[model samples]
Target: MARTTSLSGFPEWLPEERIVEQHVLDSLRRTFELHGFSSIETRAVETVEQLLRKGEIDKEVYGVSRLQQDEDSSREDALALHFDLTVPFARYVVENSGYLTFPFRRYQIQKVWRGERPQEGRAREFTQADIDVVGDGTLAFRYDVELALVMIEALSELPIPPFVLRVNNRKLAEGFYRGVGLTDAPAVLREIDKLEKIGAEQVSRNLQDTVGATPEQAEAALSLAAIRTEDTSFVERVRELGVSNNLLDEGLNELAEVVGEASRRAPGKVVADLSIARGLDYYTGTVYETVLVGHEQLGSVCSGGRYESLASSGKKTYPGVGLSIGVTRLVTRILSRSMAQASRSVPSAVLVALNDDASWSAAQDVAGQLRARGIATEVAATAQKFGKQIRYAERRGIPFVWFSSVAEDGSPTHEVKDIRSGEQVAADPASWQPPAEDLHATVLRAATTDD
Candidate 1:
């Protein structure tokens, strides 16, 4: 069973629960590889300066240093655990630019630390699975759409509730804010990002008080955020608001393309939710946020965006688009809500019974033969009674129990029993096979009950 620990932010899962998490990770890896994204892992620690350069998350950074320092030791360099994968990935791209191919595509799944208040969905330490495509200079906008589709396919494979991949362009939000006389686009966006949490009225007031937006401008900004659609109709909807600028036109065109293509490719999975501002400052173009259909209160289970100037050399810049799945949070919710669970705690499908000390070698031979045939078989640790051995297999959730005995004619005989069904039959160790589902530990969705 999973137990609560003294450390509040960190979460630990039981063996069975971990099986469910492994299933999710395996599903994500298979999907990402199918799309041709290579895997890479950056060191957990980066300089504090490098980490704080992209976002305003200073308090959340966990600094790293030696406990005992020499008086002569210099403190010129400081290190910290990375809060997200994107920042570290940007550094990886710039340092390895010479060795990497242009338009490099990579996927990273690792633990990230944050110094925030732990809650139902948020944690201080968690795993994030990220997929990104970085270009040499200019990355195509279609990647924004492709990433959404990829993530949609990835999440769909998991045994979770339906989710909506909410997408919006920073250019669209910034251009609309500019047109509405909100000079500080980031500040306005930061306030708008709180709309769902603080309510529209408070966000509107904050816009006027902090962003220096007039009443009319605040209402206009809110109106723009209120726009959402499943298709290209959002174009005319934004135009009807009468906010037009060169940047706005560009943003509208880009956003329309994403929404149109995503809806056609994976209908109803993508939503053009204008209200999603993605509070991070590094996002300069398209942004994404995903929420489960009925579990919206748990917050976004996945999110990321496009950053044009995040990774750049002196003369060369790498623009990229990506999305990250909150693996820990998603698994936590799945386990807590009983969405799915591992079929068994152990991987062994057959437990070979030991009749006596003298028969142990014969039992080992039987187990070896079963294993050679791709069956996960385990021999009894001691030559205990058959009932006790069967009880052992029952406790471990092993489905089949094998027995070896000498027949009336002094010929060796083998039999297998399905504990659940109470069925036993003679079988050959080399050719006997369990059901397909019994070959390995599988994730089983919880049965739903009508309310």
Candidate 2:
């Protein structure tokens, strides 16, 4: 049965693109584990109250309910699919507080759902990979700096173009607002966050109308947000703005430490960008956003920050800092733009050809030997003609084709042909090995339009 219509906002990948996604996820997983972060997963659903604990994100959440003859919706707590991993992870931390270790370092990669309108890079359902470090009562600031380094390390190893990790301090923005006699800092930050979406003139108007900011104060906030430096020089730039507050001083010092260390370790990989006011209400300290060199229009493909009391029991508060990569969005862009591709569409490197209907056993035997030698081999599905079998392998980009027959001495003999080079050689299955990179499908960069 075929469906009459397809749903919008839900995206699916073809085989090659799925392979590329797996490669990207595997690379991130390895990097996270290398930094001593353990893997974790949370339930897909949380109570409606828990999901709404953050703010007005309810418009994007999908609520869950059962429809039956005797289903009592009032008797049970309302449940909804999680829109992001962080919230559920926080709930898990609180629920399992006694079982988990303090300063928990964890990495979660899973599918999350939302009911938002779809766009070029946004989807209703997508995969997000997050690496977070949470501490009971207090989290160290070093994790805030080191998380960026780890993300940079992981992203550099992938096929994407060079990316700059843009760092900021929420305190700087809020404190600056406070210094300028504005009390509603979050509301002002929200307007500033829309600088690109709603243009400068509109943001300035909203900053004045919504938060009662003076004309000069709004412009000063814009100037501060616009300041971006490749080194700790951003501290001086903030100082030049003439706003002073204890929080402002603390934010400047913390941002400087992060950008300074990032510069020394991986020069040019991180920058202190002043305008990075994360609109999310939770971020309390340093925040980050990343942009690909030539693909800034895609927006920040990875972003996160520090949170206080987001994960806590009444007795103790867990302050954690983390970053999350938009896996589905990245994969979708790579495939849509032809930025990268899998070397081959199929996993099998060699297809054992069937000589005749009676020779099926011989081909299977040859495949078994190849398998024993750690080669990815598959027997022909039918007793197709030799040319047809070769064409089958060619279509799937399988590199090698094997033919088998019995010799005069009644011993089975096997021959292999490299389809890519048209080179034929008699071989012993136990000793033959394909080139390391060719043994399985590999992801590689695709040629650009100019190339």
- List per-prediction Cα lDDT, in the order shown: 0.92, 0.86
Q: Candidate 2's residue-wise lDDT over 1-451, tens digit each? A: 1111267767777677778899999999999999999999999999998888875788999988766524655524888999999889888888887888978999999999999788767889899999999988888899998998999998887777778999999987788888988888889888888887878899999988888989998898888988989998888878888988998888998898899999999998898988888777888999999988888888889999999978877868888998999988888777777778999888899999987888888778778988887889988989888899999999988999988778999987878999989999898887888889988899988655111
- On the 0 to 100 scale, the lDDT of residue 246 in model 1 is 79
Per-candidate TM equals 0.96, 0.95
Tell me the tens digit of each residue's lDDT in model 1 across 1-451. Answer: 3777689989888889999999999999999999999999999999988999976889999988789866665434788999999999999999999999978999999999999999889999999999999999999988998999999999999988888999999998899888877789999999999999999999999999998999999999999999999998999999999987878888889999888999999998899999999978999989999999889998999999999989988989999999999999999989888899999998899999998988989999999998998898899989998999999999999999999999999999999999999999999998998999999989998774111
Clashing pairs in 2: none
Give model 1's TM-score versus the native structure. 0.96
**Which stretch of 10 consecutive residues in model 1 shows the poorest summed lDDT?**
69-78
Best by TM-score: 1
CA lDDT for candidate 2: 0.86
